[model samples]
Target: MAIIKHAARQTLGQLIGANNPVVTVPDDSQRQYAWTKKEVDTYWADIQKFRLARESGKESASEYFIGPIVTITDEHVKSRSLLDGQQRLTTSTILIAVIRDILWRIGSPEARSTASNIQRDYIARKAGRREPIEYFLVLSLFDRDFFRDFIQDWNELTGKVRGVEDPKKRPSHKLIQEAYSNFESKITAELSSYSDEDSRLDWLDSLYECLIKGLVFVEIQTPTSSDANEVFETINSRGKDLSTVDLVRNFLMERSREDLEKQRVNDAWRVLLDKFDKREEIERFLRHFWVARHGDVKSHSLYATIRGDLTREFDKRPHAYTAGAFAAELESASIRYVDLIHCSTGVDEFDSALSEIKALNADALHPLLLAASEKNDYAQLQDLIEACLSYYVRWTVIGRRESTLLEENIFEVAKEFSGGAGAESILRRVCGWIPDNETFKVDFEEASIPKPSQARYLLEKVEAKLRNTEGVDELEVASSTKVHVEQIYPQQPNPELRLDEHDSWVHRLGNVTLLNGRKNQTNSNRPFPEKVSIYEESALLVSSETQVFRLWDSQKSRWRPEGIIERQADLAKTALTVWPSSSQWQ
Candidate 1:
């Protein structure tokens, strides 16, 4: 049962004005300010509609409700720890700051006076001669100082303060600056429409009044922080638009009994947001981290699954499930996860293997890779990555197997590896899913690699294999900008060529070969003899290998469909050696 201290509807003025409890977003429990221009525009549009309705004296426009906020009310300190509604509250405060600045810019006596009063009553105040200033709404640590210096703190005589930290370095700080600028532009545009200073002042005052008194929120005050957290989770779980990251952070903070434990959670979360930097990236890392240990769970159900499992664990062995322990583990895994994503493991072979996997867009292997990275030595890790790459190529890229089964098997193997399975055991498990060489060859023979980049990857791998076998240095293939995937039969051939079936053969792996330079119109669609002359002049081993076209009888030698079939068949035989089965590794 939640211990609700009070629950009542309050206007924005009543919630943050003089004598109201000073509200603060707890650093450990809440996300930073995250409203972008899109949300700000909607807010501005709503305010305009509400102001119009109120001015018309419509009884239905008594107040505009902005939804609810959950907070932990501390009477002794006359402060509240806001548990939810940071976005709305922060955005509103930003609007107020914009209004104040615009009034000061107008420079009329009444305008300046209204701005001063707005500042003192709602924005911030100096409580006493010996006291520091008190802000009405204090943001979390990530944004607190920037918000104060850039948006909340202002002076009439000197102007807005300067020398704040660089917004470029902090993502949240950039958001605050953008929101303030967005509102400033909109308000300035509206003020410009007024012909005279007096009219502008009156317009500003009416807007201010509408904002202070019209915006309403249901303030749910709880007796304790824990109660506030519980209320927040309940409200969010009922289908509010809270993120899983926010929910998980709040839950962990609620479980943290000690200040140190809370700090650990806060630090870990800061590192997470800093390392990932984007919301989607952070969410992806969280899902991969969870799946690496706890098995597969969808994004929508991730929070519920984590909460239920952690609750059970805390109930069984509280000591082992401490916030600090989880924080340490999460932080460590995030570092490794970053390395995996960026292919910066510092081992050449491992990074090379990861680069290939990335080209394949095989993100499903992240869970298994994240697990293997933690326990396996560099050698073992390299082998595991190679095996995964091979498995993905054979099972997914070539075999085009059902994805659900592949994901399921990877998730199971990731769990096993995370639970101390050795490299060989994990490798074997992953390799077991790879299609047999004959199946892979059959698929590759008929594969239509429509994507130019994927076609280049396939050809480059074969080119390297051919180079290594002939006692020559393996040429760097697709990485070089000079290298291009040239179609032996051009996509848009000369009309007289009469190549009506060009579409069926253009993208086939056999018809495309890596060339040293860009394909031009004249050289690309030329008859086979001319193209053979171009190929012989190339530096790449793959281009030189194209000399096989010279072997055909001079009179009838043209690149034909049967020629592509015969070439792809030979390439398929070589592909088995390039991306071999699990048995090759053993």
Candidate 2:
């Protein structure tokens, strides 16, 4: 093990102070600035909590840990390349700039003096021609100019608004701008609340004091690239919860032995980040990618599994693993993953089936579909997508197996697809998960219809089969029309009709059907005959089928539990047609 040097605890002021003129630069491997307003709020809340504790004498007014900072010293530049903790460091710099601007506006003699000191010590060094340009925190190359401009002339930046045009628009730069505004608003609100100059000056003094003396960091510096990479992984794994993508990216680039390989790795990684801009979404794709390659890995075990697999690959062909080969695989797989997410199924029927799957929230099918997208068989892909949607509908709208069992079944399908099984073979594997007709019918009658959108989707699918119309219009109407699941039997039982026995079936799949927005308001809670008249005017087969109901006893012409059961039984049969079993496909 290489020796990693740990500096004594340093305050934010001491760390950024110009006495050493230490510059912390971001390398190509670092993620762009991604802290959102929520994260900034959390950071400020923690600081305020610390301030309150100290002021109340509940804790020391000295040294509170901000977090750890890991860096590798660059002998050539006489600086440190920050390996982790960029988010905290960058946000803290933004806070300092906020304080400096506030103090400048306050403009008492003492306030001006304090502001000057902060600018010189913490923000930037005005280089003499003899000295190099050094900043306290130099951002990644893409963002550095925008960051430099904001720091150098923040008052002007407030008016400039950082052009929203392309090339000028970057997520990190936007975050920097937003962070400045956030801190400025907070400081302004705080100062405006103070009644007297003395109180305002006193508040400023305490805040500055806390920033310099109280906020602390444990800084560790490694001597070599490998050591820095190792430390970065260890620190982030046990603390702060960096995403799996972040860890994997760092490992690939840092392990590349040659500059050529490093460049290749960086280029490949950038393509992926650009394709999937959101960090959370990229992390999700990474998990799905893992399932596509290996079998099933739990959410918590996902990163470990990836790291282990990459290590094994590196052992087999060190150069290939380090030279962007692994990253290339990820990029290719991600194309399919993105297509699955956006439902770019090329075929209209396949896309329609996918839309229903999404409305039903069958994310378990994503990994399998991602693998399926790799095949040249569009017809087969369509068959698989339809089968998966059918499985999900039966599992979700009807009844479900144990969640773990469902997940295992889907994972097996994905594994088989990856092992080069054709659509028929892989779909043959799916047959075990589809509910039988009797079970599906029983479950359908008893199942509570879900939210309006899902319930509409279910009814619309059944309606399409009933009318034999292509589902294009039905799907559009289901989404665009402000419709709801209208109960055929009103929720409030008809006292004259005596619907108490049917009360339990009121929200069941058979009793529910769709009606446009205000029509539900008009049609709800009416007598059975009045409700039937409203259904007759509706276009949906599921609803309009209600118009022809007959009394089992012509002598007693009122809605009853048996009537609800009979209608549901017919709807259940239609549902079976809409989501047919694999045997029907054969």
Candidate 3:
């Protein structure tokens, strides 16, 4: 059973006012301020609606409940360690700061005085004349200094304070800056609607009052950290859920038996968020990390699965499953995970292979890549990457096999690799999943690549094979503005051409080739002989190859369906050399 010290509804002003305990986000329980533009817009809209309803004196007018906050209070220190609701509290403080800045800008005696009083009561205050000022709400280590210097300590006379860090470099600092600017724009617009200074000041005051008095929260106070953690989990589990990252962090913190263990977890989490700043990136990395060692699990059930599995492990071998151990492992793996995503392996051949895999958008193979990166040397790792790329090109891109089976097989291989399976063993398993050369050739002959980018990638690879150069450089191909994917049989061909079965042949691999400069559009719907002259002058080797099909017959030079079939057959034969099978690898 958990002990709850008190639970009651309180206004935002009552929660952060001079008479209440100072609110602080503890180091072990802090996540960076992560509310983006979408969240800020929603919050502002709600406040506006609530203010209008209250002003209208409607029966529906009621205090707006922002959400619940769980805290552990320490009377001796006169402070509360906020375990939940930091996002709401931090955002609310930012709104107040924006209002204060607007009031100061009004340049009236009453307005400035009201702003000063609001600052002292809700922003920050000094206990005694001689004591240093204490902030009303202190954020975590990552955002504490930036928040204080830029927001809490804004100069009343000068109207600005020097920022502690560059907002562009820090993701949380960027969010804070955006939120402040967003509120300032909206509030200033509202103030501009009133002509006289008095009306403007009144409007500002009303907005401030509406925020402090109208916004409500169910404040749940606990006697100890343990009690606070328990209540936090229970509340979040029932109503609107917290993020998976948040839940997982709190779970680890709650199970930590010592302060050092808790710090280790916090330190690891800080490293992770710093590496992958965006929420989606962090979540994806977590899921990939889990799938690499364990097996396939949906994103929604990841946290529950982690908790259940870890709990069972803890019961069996408590010492091995310590929080500190897991924290260290997670931190170490994040470094490799970053390398995998960014293709910064520092080897040209290896990075090229990784680029091709990325181009294919084969994220299902990340688990196996992450495992191979950990278990193999550079030589073995290179071979494994090539094997995975080949398998993906044949199975998914060409053969168009079902993805579920591929994901399952890759995940199983990743699990084995994580358990010390050799690179050769992993390669054999991946190669076994690939379609045979004959099957791949058949699929390639009939493949219709509708996506221009995918078509460009295939053509570029074949071009590289012809020119005897590395074709897997994603930057060279993806970033090149000079090269374009030209359709030989233009989708909107000129009506005079009288082409038959246009859709059937337009997107086929044979009809697509890379062209230089503006020739793609300039040669649009031109007869085969006219385009043949431009193809012969092309810079790419693949474009020049199209010259062979200029005259399907000597009597009259014209492109026909027979030409497309013959060209695709030749390209299919080349594909076998580009993406070989298991026997070729052996």
Candidate 4:
């Protein structure tokens, strides 16, 4: 009974679960877990790596997985149980299924022989005539549906299942066929890259070792039959997630008829949870609400606190605790509504100052609220602001919080100012420092730059800011600095204005930029061609007309207002980089 490493591809054609600690098979019950397609795919790809490594003459015996060694006796297969790792054994079977299919496809003497050997051992009917699957026989005990899905997907990818599209019957089987063909092509093409077949096999084996070998597992050996029910229940805890009601029911193990308070709390929780319909959002909010109000939130820990029996037996006092009616909420929403939750109200209640956040989505707002209430850390608040800003830029509806404009103002006034990454970062800091929420403004604008809907925003403030710096609120310049924009070229492409008959001048914001009253009027009716000549004559202008044009092009893009698609890639990249994490700011 000494544990030891066992090579997955060592060709040991039996799983008799010898009392040897060197190898074992996982029980079938454990294999019923939902090992996702994504996880399985990753494992297959890794095994391919192992295959290649071995072909390159680098396969190391020092590295091997410690899996189960189950004695797969199909003749008296009453218990198709696993003696070791379920997740690993199940995945390896699927991988073998894949390789076997591929070998069958190759149709060479060696390939067919290998495929036949594989099938007859793991899958064929006659127990005595056929060899047992040499590897991972323990997972054979998994449920039928799991095995069926594995086989179907394998068939689809390996060209065994020919799917067709009959008009309106089931989405033109053609789509499924085509999808399967494409997937098969990708997997096989990837596999075919190896120069030698042995290398390919070893690559697959390495994948198994990397993903499954090192994992810790609860090794259960069934030597005795007593207390098996308790074993099953305890195992279920670590297996699939249990329902809240079921969990709360387990909490009743300590409850008694004399414990009236515990009984009441249990009843209230059940009715409330049922009404909410298992909405994870409502539960999260309730969790936070409990923390904010009572300083202790977990209901399990409060069982004795609410029980009458503990009042005398444990010196529990009648602490006044009231939870607003619990049944007024929803517990679950559709996948599309993952971020959203339903309460008695609607999704819009989050914005309603007077509206209680009964039904809503967690989004960025939920985490922010939790962090603020639970930890009261500024870093959390800042992260919340960033998330909200990013959501804002993307136009995604997640959740709501205070305006970034306000947060930015607060950041600005904190006495440190440095700027990089984008103008927004610098601007946020400046705005926050001013300590005035009302004055700072943010806008989503279309800059004269073409389709690159990058940030076309402007930051401005009342002259009061300057007034504070200079000891006066009103200024000679009026309300604020008049830094308005004038696009030299428009964003919309003018098929009509193809006067040049070339794509030239397509990037102009129509020659827009900051201008004073008289200067704006003087250049109002002139085209950029004429305006440039006139501007070149100005001795007061330090920049040449050529430099100005280049600068304009860089700002808006080479095609500024018209052919927007050309500039979009760069613009999109920038927007994605600087877009605030929140979507709520104006």
Each model's lDDT: 0.82, 0.71, 0.80, 0.35
**Highest TM-score against the true fold, candidate:** 3
Q: Residue 364, candidate 1: how far off, in angstroms?
A: 1.8
RMSD of 2: 4.5
Task: Tell me the lDDT of model 3 at 534.
Answer: 72
Residue 533, candidate 2: alpha-carbon lDDT: 62
Q: Using Cα atoms with residue i matched to residue i, what is each candidate's TM-score against the true structure?
A: 0.81, 0.83, 0.87, 0.36
lDDT of 2 at 42: 92
**Per-residue C-alpha lDDT of model 2 across residues 496-550, encoded as one tens digit per residue:** 7655555466766666777754654555876666666667776666677643354
Cα RMSD, each candidate: 4.8, 4.5, 3.8, 16.7
Better of 3 and 4 by lDDT: 3
Instruction: Give the least accurate 10-residue stretch of model 1, judged by summed lDDT.
Output: 546-555
Output the better candidate (1/3) by TM-score. Answer: 3
Query: For candidate 3, what is the total of clashing residue pairs?
Result: 0
Candidate 3 structure lDDT: 0.80
Each prediction's number of clashing residue pairs: 0, 0, 0, 88
Better of 2 and 3 by lDDT: 3
lDDT of residue 327 for candidate 4? 16
> Considering every candidate listed, which one attains the maximal lDDT?
1
